[model samples]
Each structure stands twice: as C-alpha cells, then as structure tokens.
Target chain A: MLLLSACGAREVVVQGNFPKPLMDPLPLTLGVIYTDEFAQHEIFDEAAGRAESDWLVKTGDAQVEFWNTLLNGMFQEVVQIKDSQTLEAYKNTVDAVIIPAVADLQYTIPLHTNIKIYEIWMKYRFKMVSLEDVHGNENGDLSIKPDQYFADWTLTAYGKTPTAFLQSDEEAVNLAAVVALRDAGANFATSFSRVPDIAAWMAEGLQPPPAEATDIQRLEND
Target chain B: MIRVIQGKLIAGLVLAMSILQGCVNATVDEMTFLEPTEGIGDASVVIIGRRHAPDYETEFDFIECIGDHIRRGDNSISVLHELDFINMMYPWFEPRTAPLRTDDIEKLLSQERVANRFEELKLEYMIWIDGSTIETNSSGSMTCGVGPGGAGCFGFGTWGNAADYEATIWDFTDEIEVGRISANTSGQSYMPAVVVPIPIIAPVQGTACDSLGDQLLKYLSAKM
Candidate 1:
C-alpha cells in the first residue's frame, strides 16, 4: 500500500500531476553496473583447473541465455563494465542520491537436512553501491531496485567445493542484476500502467540458490 | 507396432540393468558443512576421508600416522582420529593400523561410504563433505608406496608435494582455503626403494617435516 502510494505520487510528479503518466523512455546514463566481476572471473574450483582464458565471454553469453529462459524482455540488453572508472562513475551516481538496499540484512534460513555440518544460520545484509555517474545512477535507479535483482553461477561439476555445485556466487550476482532490472522496470511501469506482472517482478527476491541439496555450498568459512 | 518396439527396447534395458545393477546404481547422500567462526589453528580439525569411487576397501595409514603424531606431542597438539583403530592381534601388509575398527562395521555400513567429520572437534556440531575428491594411486612421507589412493583416487606423492595434494581438498571448496603446506617424511625415514630397482622421483625425504603421521598431523591440523 505504501509503495503503491509512493508510486502514485511519483507518477503524478513525472507527468506534471496530470494523470496519464505516459512518459517517454529515457536513455541509459550509467549503463548496467556489476561489481566484484571487475577482472577475470571464475565459477569453478581452481583445483579442477578450469581455464579462464575465455571466461568472461562464455559467462556473459551463458548469463543472457539463462535470463532469456527465465524472464524474457525484462532487459533491453545486458551490459558488462568496461573498466574501474566506469564502475566508479556508476558508484558515484548510486551513492549521490539513490540509497541502495542493505544486502547485509540477515536472513534466517531454516532447513530439514539434519546434517549438523550445515547449521542453520543468518547472513549479514549487503548493500549495493552503484558504479555510475549521477545521470547513470538515475538510469539504474529509474530502472531497478538492486535488492530484488538475482544472479546465478553454473558449476562445472557437482561436489564439495562451493563453486563445485550447480550455480556459483558470480552467477547469483548476475541473476540479481537481471531481477533488479525487472523490478526497476516494473516499478517505473506501475507508476503509470496497471499491468499485473508486478507479482512476477517481485518473485526474483528468492534466497541465494541453496547449495546443491547434494551438500555443496560456498564461502565454506561462512 | 512402434509401441511394441518401444516396449521391447524398454524390456531389453531392464534386463540389461538387472545384469548390470551394480554399474547402474550409486547412492548419493547430500551434506552441508559450513566453516566454523574459529580459524583452523585454534581447533583440532577433523577431515573425514571421503570414499573416492570403486575401491571397496578402506585405507588407514594416513589417519593412523596423524593420530600417532598428535598423541605423541602437545595436548593442544594431540589429534583424536588415528591408528588407535589399529588391530594389534594380526600384523599384515601395511604395518600400520586397520583402516576402520571391525566393531564399527555395522555403524559404518548403515551409512553410505561417508567421511563424517566433526570439523571443529567442537562437540556441538559436525560437518561432512557434500563433494567428491579424486582417488589416487601414489604415496608420500613415511608410508611412501604407490597404489590406489582410494576408490577412484590416485595417491599423490608419486609426483607432487603435500600442497599438490591440497588441490584435491581445494577442489571441494572454492578457494575457501588459501594457505600452503610443505613437509618431510617423519619418524624413521627409510629410502623408498633402497633394495628395489624402480626408484621413486620425489625422494620421500625429510627436509619436509618429521614423521609421516606427525608431519601430516601437524600440517593438516591447521587448514580452513
């Protein structure tokens, strides 16, 4: 209800408080921003000796493929960060005005797998810092909520290592970005339109994919 | 007619599976082991030996060696999992202790091949690997002989250092562990092939650690 009211207020202001709310779509200022994947990334056990020579290319393709399967058309396109400066630009934009959510918020996970090795625990919330300029920040903010975004990583093998499991931390981050885009777009649309897919937009808020029920989880330290 | 062909194929597969049931089946038990807040050194870490693949027999030399070393020294030093499982009544090929206690067979059998580890030695919780480690056929340190490391495992030492073997452990955790280890053959170093003609390459020598068990007990004793 509160979000709906806020949406109503914002929509009114965007359209001069008139009511039709059919504003034209704007250009992307910051470009889609992703963190931690600044350099080469790996979603496999280094011990397995997987090559990263062409990792970014393969991963980018794989990520687009997964989102296309899960939520089509939610993004105009998926973009990767070219350099730290761009990332900084995106970050500045986000920090200047948009208050990203606290990912550090704790999540109490309950499980039935009786395995004591995996104790039920909580995760500290983490907040996303945008890596865009002020305009870029507006582009991301005007489009999506970072918290609702989902990312995923696919594993090369099924086993003990956290990356050994099916989806990896990097992949999870990518999934989050896609979901964020979906939510951001939905928020923008709902301000003017009354489409029902808002529920679908919200569904991406699911917890990090659990380690393969086969016992594979990441951050062994946590 | 097509249905009949499909049925025939299905029946053939079932018949073949009956003959090859052993090959067709594997029971997979899922596990989740979260790291303790405490780092490796503070606690006596227990790394349950995972069963690789195909090898039905259990190997005990490594565990025995660790236990002996842990027992011989510091209280903060002594390790609980070792040759205390050895059966003294009968002496055989390995000269070390038995891989597992015969009395514990029913307990062990009830569970699919598993390395149930009490990670922190903390009585409150335990952790088990939900991943697989490759089996090897080489050895290093004091008990340097070459054979199946475990089911599908290839014993390491035939070529690399203990750090090399760490690769197997790392493969199970995505760089969750980042330190390195180096050790020498411990307790009574004997030339691997003194009289035998085929020489081992890495010289199962002592510049590394002390005795095999003591060295392993000391080193592996502190991993994340």
Candidate 2:
C-alpha cells in the first residue's frame, strides 16, 4: 500500500522573482483588471498510471507578479482595478483597459521519453479595450463604451527544464512554469505594440493634420 | 592464509577504485573569424546559454563551469553572471527576445535603454553557448530480489552518453562574431552487480565543460 501510495499526488506552488522590463514606456494610461479566478488559478491533472503522479500546480501569485512588473514597465501609468465594474468606474480616467486570463496549460513529462525533461505550455487570453477614440476629439477626451473592446488576442508560451539535474517532479514543474511566465512576459513586452489594432491605434495618434487644414492655416498666416 | 586474504582484499579495493573512475573522451575545436585586437582591460564579457531550441537547451551549470575556468588563471577577464545580465537586461535577453544574429544585436543596441545598459556594463563580448549532453544508448538490465535467506541483486547494464556543445563569441565592440569553439565528449557507463550493485558513471558532460572552458580561456585571453 505504501509503495502504491508513493505516486499519489504532487503539488507545486510556482514562485519566482520577475524583473522589471528595460524598455521605454508607452505614453498611455492603462487600467488592468485581474479577475478572482486569474489571481488564484490552479490546474489539476489526474494520474494516468500507477507510476505516474497527479499534479496540482498553483501559478496564481507568479502570474500576478509577472504581469504587474511587465505592464508597469511597458506603460506610462498602470491602474490596478478590482474588476470590470471598477474598470467601468475608472473608464474616463484611463486611456485603455486590459484584462488577462489563462486560457489553457499543458505539460509533458519524461515517462514517455528516455530523456529526463519536463515541459510546460501556456496560452493567455488578453482583452484590450481602448477608451480613447482613434481620431482626435474636440475636448481631447475619447471615451468609448465600457463593454466594447478593440482587440482580443491570444498569446502562447513554452518552457522546459534546461537540464536533467532536477529530480523532484514538483521542482521541475515550478521551474518550467517560471520559465514559461518569463517567456510570456518577454513576448508581451516586445510584441504588444505590434498587435494590429494596437499598432493602428498608436499610429493614429501620430498622424499628421489633414492637408486641407494645413493649407487653411497657411492661408490664414498669409 | 591471513596474508592471502589481505592481499585479495587489497586487490578488490584497487579494482573497485579503477572501475569507479569511468572512461571519457573529449575533443575541442575552435574557429576564429576575426582576431581580437583590443585587450579586455576594464571591460566585461557575458556568457549566455541558448535555450530557444525546441529539443534541447544549453545547461546553465556548463556555462558557469566555463566562466569559472576562464577566471581561474592569471590576468583573467571580467565575467558577468548569466542570470544577472539577463535580469538586468530583462525581456531583451530572454530566450524569446534574445538576438540570434550579429545584426540583431546591433539593432538591439541601437535602442537607447539597451545602449545605456551595455555601456554601463562595459560589455565587450557576448559568448552564446548552445547544445546539451544526452544519453545516446542503453543496453542490458539487472534484477534485484529479496528472500528469507538474503537479498541480492544480479544484473549487468551499460549505457552510452554524449555531450556536444558550441560557443559563438560576439565582439560587441566591433559588432561581429569574432570566434567559435565547440566541444564533443562521449563515454560508456557500466553497472555490474553480484550481490551488491556497483555503478561506474562516465563524466562525459564534465569533460566537455572542461575542454570547452579551457579553449575559451585560451581564446579570450589571447587577445589580452
């Protein structure tokens, strides 16, 4: 019974120190909402065989920490709101609102291979709602409806143990999770502005005045 | 009779020690693209491991071993810890975001923040190590059993391991790949048991690390 019970369960609480990204912040205020489910996310996978163990991985704290550090570095101002309702309350105070959720997570173990490697894959769903209008407004305030989102995208990240030195399954999973989180942070930081909608939004802000308006100003000066 | 038994015990001890120290063969090769001109006076260098490969990753310990070897001899160059450099550079040096080519690095340095950090670190070279040690083959097995009379393990097993790694040196000052070094090591490990199992492990990865490290030391210090 003891021998059989040896493969009962493996639990891991992922933790790591996430560094602030070293990039110029975008000139926009962002309101972020971390849902309760996102802040306390965990995944459980049942054991498939007598030799395989069940895994319960808790990645809540690390997720919040990583995204917080990344967003703080990527934007000029970040406002952490309680939920969507709070975001609605602060709609006029911020340029955009972003909500992030874990879409899915998958893992692989060495039981299927000769190499002692552990890998983790994560998919994240992000909803970005632009409160400001793409075109200039009379009062320079472009508040859109709270429920409308300009961009909803998914990002995937992957991580694996670099070496076979780690023996414990829990430790391996934690390390893999941390690596995946770091990869996600890197991907988001480098590619956030490149997302088509975000790019168009930013470009709109930089657009030159209309040619007719320029000619009218020139005529007035003459 | 007593002397004979003592002699036999001494022989057994000698045989066990010999078996414990496994056999490993390692080779290192270097290719210099452009010779280094300036000395490393006050500048530092960072050794990073490539982890972007889908199948394998360069071990962190191996990179650290190479760093330790480089710093061992006289007039050692300044070496930065891989994690420290990665953390300081943040997303830029991550596995997904790291520059894969010399021109990519130049473009990264064009950024004001990256440029500032590079200048602050006084980084002159960046050595990116890529590869891994893997067990190539395994054969034979042993069985262990316990009985009322006694417990015994009887089996013979053997396995083969190989370590292959390559290091590419990028001269940040010149914004070019200056040199490359590669190491390949392989060995066979054995386990033969009668009543008690004895394992003889071949240190292939360690041998590869040492060989690669020595060559990097010689190559980098030669510039100074």
Top TM-score hit: 2
| TM-score of chain A, every prediction, order shown | 0.21, 0.79
Estimate, for each residue in B50-103, the C-alpha lDDT of model 2 and write its tens digit. Answer: 988888888888889888878875255899999999999999988899999998
Candidate 1's displacement at residue A213, Å, is: 40
**Judged by DockQ, which candidate is best?**
2
Question: Residue A182's C-alpha lDDT in candidate 1?
Answer: 28
The fraction of reference A/B contacts recovered in model 2 reads 0.88
Q: In candidate 2, residue A91 scores what lDDT?
A: 65
Model 2 docking tier (incorrect/acceptable/medium/high): medium
Flag regions of model 1 displaced more than 4 Å: A1-222, B1-42, B55-58, B82-120, B123-175, B178-224
- State how far residue B81 of model 1 sits from its true place (Å): 1.7
CA error at residue A210 for candidate 2, angstroms: 20
Top candidate (lDDT): 2
